[model samples]
Target: MKPAKDWHAAPLPADEAKRLRQLRSLALLDTPQEEVFDRVTRVAAELLQAPIALVSLVDEHRQWFKSRVGLDVCETARDVSFCAHAVHSESLLLVEDAHADARFAGNPLVTGAPHIRFYAGVPLRSSGGLVLGTLCAIDTRPRKLTPAKQAALCDLAATVEREIVQREAARETLEVQEVERRKLRVSESRFHTIFQRTPTGKAIVGLDGRFVEVNPKLCEITGYSADELMHMTFQEITVGADLPADLELVAELLDGRRTTYSFEKRYRRRDGGTVWIDLSVALIHDDEGKPMHFVSTMQDISGRKHSEEVLRGYRQELERRVLERTRELTSSRTALQTITDNLPVLIAHVDADLRYRFNNQVYRDVFGVEPSSLHGTTVRETIGAAAFEHCLPYFARVLAGERVAHEGIVYEGAPNRMWNATYVPEFQRGEVAGFYIMSQDITETKQRENQMRSEVMLDALTGLPNRRALAEQLALSIDAARDAEVPFALFFMDLDGFKNVNDQHGHDAGDALLRQVAARLKKTTRADDLVCRLAGDEFVLLARGITSTSACSRIAQDICRAIARPFEVGQSEARLGTSVGIAMCAGGTQTSAEAILAEADRAMYEAKRKGRNGFRFASLLAEVAPAINNLVDRGSATRH
Candidate 1:
């Protein structure tokens, strides 16, 4: 054995501190003996017929044996270890005779018992480029190791490295899984609470439509006990007119053609009265994606339905009095017709069959038809197919004793006009007999509203999406990416030397340059990619479905090159470059839009720091040093 004094006097490698950290990260030092490591050492010793073999991890003060054969001691002083020198080399270190070597001539290990003579060790390097220790073979007799033996030792060391890396990876995977499991447990707990307390009539129904489970609200809505509802199928309670449609939707769900559906339907309560409900139903699936059951939420809308009926009745009574007065003043028909013909709004009455029973002169003027010709014509024939389809659903609701009002476009004249149309049901003997239609032009109002909305969402100078629009789109993109599990990259770009343009060439010229830059960015990116003017001299690009960092870098490069081209502003040409920072989220990573934007912003500044006109990916900065270095070198070359 070597003297303890000499062991403390041995010089440490330059990377000794870093290597010790890497060794500790493996967590193999002073660990219990593992059969896997022991097997490797045993095989290595048998191959070389060495008296001793060890898998040694060099720590700050000691060389610890993770696995050893023909060795009673667990550790030795680091300075006295042959493996210490091996850890400093990238390849195998061999000594045919330690006694003859100058470094070991006065060493106690060579001069004392268990005399060291021959030694061969291969450095075990970590993925981070730090050599943690060595896989070594030792012998008391002075003998040289052949080329084959040296190669074998290196191979064994590589195996040891692989084992350590694999173990670390396995541990990390287990930790991630544990975190996920805990989150799932919390989510399930919250879901259970909401499912039990939600006020909506929630129920779980079997594929056959029989109630498998029902909440308290469902029982109250249906006026049935839980036991009563469980014994009945959903089709049994549904109104006859709505049953067929509901059954078709349920069939679609079972066949996997649709996962969820919503519709307005009527159901018969236990008391034999009809209740209107807005029903939303979804199918739950098993692990294999087989349909398991239907989850349904029903909200009662009977009060709203009743209010509509009451409003329809009052309107119908008013229409009846007006018709009676018109009949009574028939003797003054010419005066009445003259007054109505001069009015701007269109007025008409349609019977339950949708046939026009009456129409004023203004209605004829709007449709470009004679007043007499439209009296007996159906609305569909008078308005054309597209408009008829648009009005049909509201008409049906009107005929169902509901007052309906909606806005629509009419394209009959030289210019298209928008109209606010109201349909009031004419009730007779507690049923809808006909309906009166009133339409008022609102084209200018609609146009102004649309213009205001556009102004709010668009950048006034560049005509690109403004910050508000970018935020909205970014939110949508994040949701879509999460749902589809697709990767996307967000780039935060700032224009370099833009302030100089404003200083040298006036603000108008600066604005012009910005508009040109926006156009260039739009032209250089894909149609689906969103490029927005975030603020003055700043823009953002959201690139979807990126395959890799290389692709994202290419996009940034394209933008840089496009913006670098000279811009013509009135009498002068302006030049500016773009610096970009990219933040990426792969599929299934839960990251917010704001988080990604912040990350990209930080990276953008990093690019600017490394001399502008380049892009840097946030993830690669810490994990891939070589790639980052290469990017910097390439960027410098491009600048030159």
Candidate 2:
């Protein structure tokens, strides 16, 4: 068992004393409860479902209740006052269960007297951002509030605030009448009011530079209390180097030489840190025109100074990088010249007007023009008019930011040899400035176009078409399917248990297993179907003339059964299943090879998730676009 908390007044806000002054100035203390206030509390008590409601004013030693309903007391000591704690909060202080909160548990209010179990209050504030008191609700039982109820309570609190502001305005009107008799007194009061509430740091400095008066904003900027500043002179906290210039300005102001002065300087904080401030000062004269005080205003500019320094560093670093890039480009131009000259190719830089900028050394041997002399010469002069006509179409493409590659007898010059030319666009700030040409004499290679290059397209282990050949075949098949008004299906397959076969039997057996799987796939598909080995144990099949999904499923089922048969490898037996994903492509559909490959790969993983040795459609795991879904049959495009 723990003893009850004897004292829980809570820590006060920095403006607590000023708030107390404002609360007392309202002149509502110890007054009889009025209908204006009781009417609001009556609404809050009923709307919040609380037993008691009060418009509580917190004084120096106690919370005095101006308006109350469902409660007997008019006042409670500050030590046991919930409104006293609520006054420190900027907004509502809601305690669902006072008995469960460590700060309020076992307090006198919960253990005796009102026996408060639930408490909620909204801190009433002044125009100067000071919390004066709270409009509170009290309950004898532990309870909770919905967001709607809490909002309703805030609306009720706003009514109480409007009533308080009206009373304060009336009191100010009376005080203004009394101060109007003395003009200087009214001016001084207004000055004090602005000095306390202004966001900028301000102070009244004595002529002798000794301690005078500092506002809360100044104290906040210098990280010092008003008491600490009052005991010290301005010179005590100013940076030593800045003191001389500041004193010169202050002297001129007093001697009627300068009316005001403004400058940027450093001020030393109490914590031994320096802060940059934009300081502006003006002379204040009292009655009879005698210079009285210097009113100094300061704004913290440390953040601006930091950002300027960072921007300067970034600018210098960018300049250095630009210089480095220039040197690298110079070296690369020299290296590219040497490399292009060694190859049997005519390389040149041509401007947008079709005139040459420069040419490689090979141009001298091929075109009978010196590399430097080729500059300023038109392509019609070097390669003849017929070649320039052929080059016009390529120029349009490269200038439009497309790289063009073609090989034919376009340049019908003296030798009349076929040339394979690639035009690469040069860009300056995202615009096509010009282009560089790399033309190789591939006249011999074109003669062997009809030859079958088995080394490039055939798989060495499986004797099937590899990925390079598969790409060419797939493109042809897609065009054929679109022209013939038929469809094609792509099957992406992956071995499931093949890793075990490789680990237990070794790489030799794994190679043999893949070769056997490829042969099985070839035997399982139709004569028109193309079985291609993509990479490792993964294979792809392109079956054109596919009109229905059932036909594709039949082919996948046959391949899966063939691969599941037992294999013989180095006197050891191993088995692995296959997962197939089919990507259905209907006729006249504009589908990219990459999109189809990705779709099939994702569906293959879905098939793996459905216990292996199974096949799934890409549409089962991915959403097909409306255009593509409309092209294919519903059975092939049904989303899972």
Candidate 3:
């Protein structure tokens, strides 16, 4: 058994003991071998003209050799080793002969191993005067060390101390690095969790345009599997025509010129369709401050793009029509004649007797007469009395010197198509000369106008009826409900936790999620049901003819589940749960449409307060309840 550690083996000051502990904590007392130490020991041995030189670490009960130039063993017991006592000395410990030295005369190592005869060692001390170990040179022959040789030996030991400090510093740095690596690993796991499951597309792109990392949403949006997208360039999935001229922006980022860029661009969907995406890109720089690569977020904007296109078309059409009308009104008579003759507008003249006089080719052809025959013919003579009866009042007003202008009526003598006509009484010297008729073939125009009016009532983003159209539908529905004495439910729904996606991802992703929510609502509701968008994430559903509160509640649950389904947008999967408000008409109660809509909206807010992703049916019960019951019931039934 080794003797108990001698805490008071020597008289040492408090500061010196503290520093000695620090030096010991460096863990160099018993260490492995290395070339820097070996070289030092080798040089020390050669300079001292000794057979052996050692860099030794002294522990409590043993001395461990870090490097021994002429010795084969790595360590020895403290009872036999000279370095064990050398560590206690502040300076060199010289033993001229271990045989004569009482401390080693009975040591088994000195008698058996390469016998250490002449020994000199210097303490390896820290800056604070803590002796950790020794660097000693050994010789086989008994000899005394010279003063200069002793000094050189001390310097060499000091060099060893410096090496120990450098090693300790390097070890501490390695430990710190290991701790940082562990933290980075945990952070990377968290990042993966967010990247793989987030609701928006995310990617790390190389300077060469290759994707270093891509989220699942990106895989879904591009129609390629996640494995496939990872090996591809961003350009591979990008539609070439839609690629921006500033693709060099990525290069600039790599060259340290820019930090971030965002743009609207198109990507080729897996199904070979084009999907519009708004991309936000940021450059990642290395430690040297050179841009290494880029990280980007992609959001789907196909619906918004479609809405923008429709709005642009409407604006352009309005502008074009305004310009065309301006030109027609400002041009000369010859130009007018040319336009009227070539265009679908019908133009002609009638005399005070309602006779077809000056007429364009269309008028001549419609009247089935030459200009000579129709010039002086009366309406009764040219078109027959039946046609004459339709326009006699207008002609009488013109003949009485009153100018007439109206739409929705036209009269042609021979072959007249259904036309919308405007009649103006031409004046001559302050008296009515004859009627100048301008008619247009507006059959296609009327059809298109009606179509546009219907479309304007629908939400372009969701394909649901918009608020304007909902008002009309509600009014009509209310009338039918009143007549039949039947009650209907009005449900207002708002998605839960939807704002976070907008904040973290972007507006484009938010819009896409809204569209998906709209689709889910449509799918969950009955086909006959009318769902309307009240703008900005608000929806109103009229369960056109519901039976009871329970029935309406069932529909609301369905909606909640439908919305809760993962929304795979771009490169991310997001869950936008719903909070629904339900208000059922009292089956026969007389209430305004506005009142019902407001009640539904209020209830929806109540649902939001009771924790989102839930439903609140309008009072009999105003108190909030745990939504778990409803979710469980819904889950069981809908699972099939």
Candidate 4:
């Protein structure tokens, strides 16, 4: 205790004192006794051998005890405490005795409870030169301190300052650690949310390949429960074929070659089917930068895989078919070219514009040009307008889908060659793409045609000339038949019940039966006989100059037997019979060979009406014809 001059009065700068009070107010004053505070107080008390020691904080109104040994309740009023004076003074304050020193003689602490008589206090300074407070010791009896003890106390106060600094550093470190811990908690929450909510399956894996975490999506993809998956390694669930590749990718991630790796793999389900998955793997590192675990994301890609495979197969198949078609088309094109080149007839094709699109070698040769030069050349340009006009009407009719056929001579360009030409329409996509023209050089055919026209008599079935060569012949019959006249057969026969045959069987069967009969008749006839298929199985035979009727009868009877045979019509058996009518010019009264053929045709029907399968005489038809068309032209009359 001391008698103080006005307590706030001090020799320090007013602002410095205010700042020092602020510094001291920041809890250098009267704190709870702890190791940091007590260590300094205890050392000072022991070295000084005083009854009490204190590290005090002096505020404007009170001296507060920061650390004290042997002091009670931690504080005293500023007016009564000697340490308050030590705080304002930069140097030490010492009082030998309050009773003996007039300055503290009237202090209540010396006259009242826990009276202090001897006191010494040294000012404690902060690093900023603020007087924080004092390190002071007290005695109930007047005492003196040794110099060493005094110095030791000052050193102990400096140690307390250093302890405050160290304690502050510890507190800052604890706050930093707390903040880091909170960040870790937030990051963990975020990671968990992402793992569960992502569309793909995600997992953490141990180095031993066990799952540390497997999301619901992972469970679904693998077709395993979470509990089941937890007991199995990824190797056991992955398809065997995909395991090796997966291992390689995992190795890359674990080796730090990549932080993340991705690949497509298959996972085998419990039912033994496999699901395709796209896997992305990443390595997680520990604080020390060592591999801690693997994190993987799996995406189901079965649909995509199947689509790609199917599309790839379709593409490959389409390419194969395309190649096959191209090869076939090429072969067909080459064959068509060969056939066209070798054909004797001229062939040409023209487009919508009447320009030659394609033409055979004959056409090119007839026009006196290379085949290639004819392409895209109009008929008028290539052959002059006169030839084009002659062909234009046929072209127009063909373009209108009308089939135009004409047999007349026309002179082509280049050497004035004449041809009998015909044009056909070629359709594409239901429209006429072009015209196809064929022409034959008829310069020699015309001569043959003229010679054929001179002989008016012809085989009724085959439309070839028949044996009118006898009377119309200016030479011997045999020579006239062979060279002077194109003598052919007029075989006269009747189909027995030909009407009933058509009725009993269907028309299709009857027609088929007739065609078969005609084929057999053609086979039986002479190769040069000109076998004619007449209507309703009535055939004529001009057995020209037969050596005898016996030979002709044998031939006719053989044909009759041939017609009596069985035939197979579709799904049924059929039988046919015939009657023969013999007609020949072997010195008969008929003047011309036509008279004999007319008689035989009439006699054949008569044999059919008479009990069939029997031959009849020519006199019967001559008798019937007079009543029928009266101009029967009996000039070459029939003789019976």
Per-prediction TM-score to the true structure, in the order listed:
0.46, 0.31, 0.35, 0.27
Candidate 1 lDDT over residue span 171-222, tens digit each: 6788778868898675455546755689789888998889977877878888
Identify the runs in model 2 with alpha carbons over 4 angstroms from their true place: 1-7, 184-640
Models, CA RMSD each = 14.7, 28.6, 28.7, 58.2
Q: Count clashing residue pairs in model 1.
A: 0
Model 2 residue 157 CA deviation in Å: 0.5
Best by TM-score: 1
RMSD of 2: 28.6
Report the CA-based lDDT of candidate 3 relative to the real structure.
0.71
Clashes (backbone N, CA, C under 3 Å), per candidate, total 0, 0, 4, 10
What digit string (tens of lDDT, one per residue) describes model 2 on residues 358-451?
Answer: 6778888887768888789887788877887877898899989997865674564446578877777878899987887777776666555434
Which pairs clash inside model 2?
Answer: none
The C-alpha stretches of model 3 lying farther than 4 A from their native spots are 1-344, 348-359, 363-402, 408-420, 424-436, 441-488, 524-530, 543-554, 585-589, 606-616, 619-640
**Which candidate leads in lDDT?**
1
What is the C-alpha lDDT profile of model 4 across 540-591, one tens digit per residue?
A: 5445545444465567767877887888878777777787665544332222
Better of 2 and 3 by lDDT: 2
Candidate 4: minimum summed lDDT over ten consecutive residues — where?
Answer: 631-640
Question: What lDDT score goes with residue 277 in model 4?
Answer: 92
What is the TM-score (0 to 1) of candidate 2?
0.31
Tell me how candidate 4 scores on lDDT. 0.66
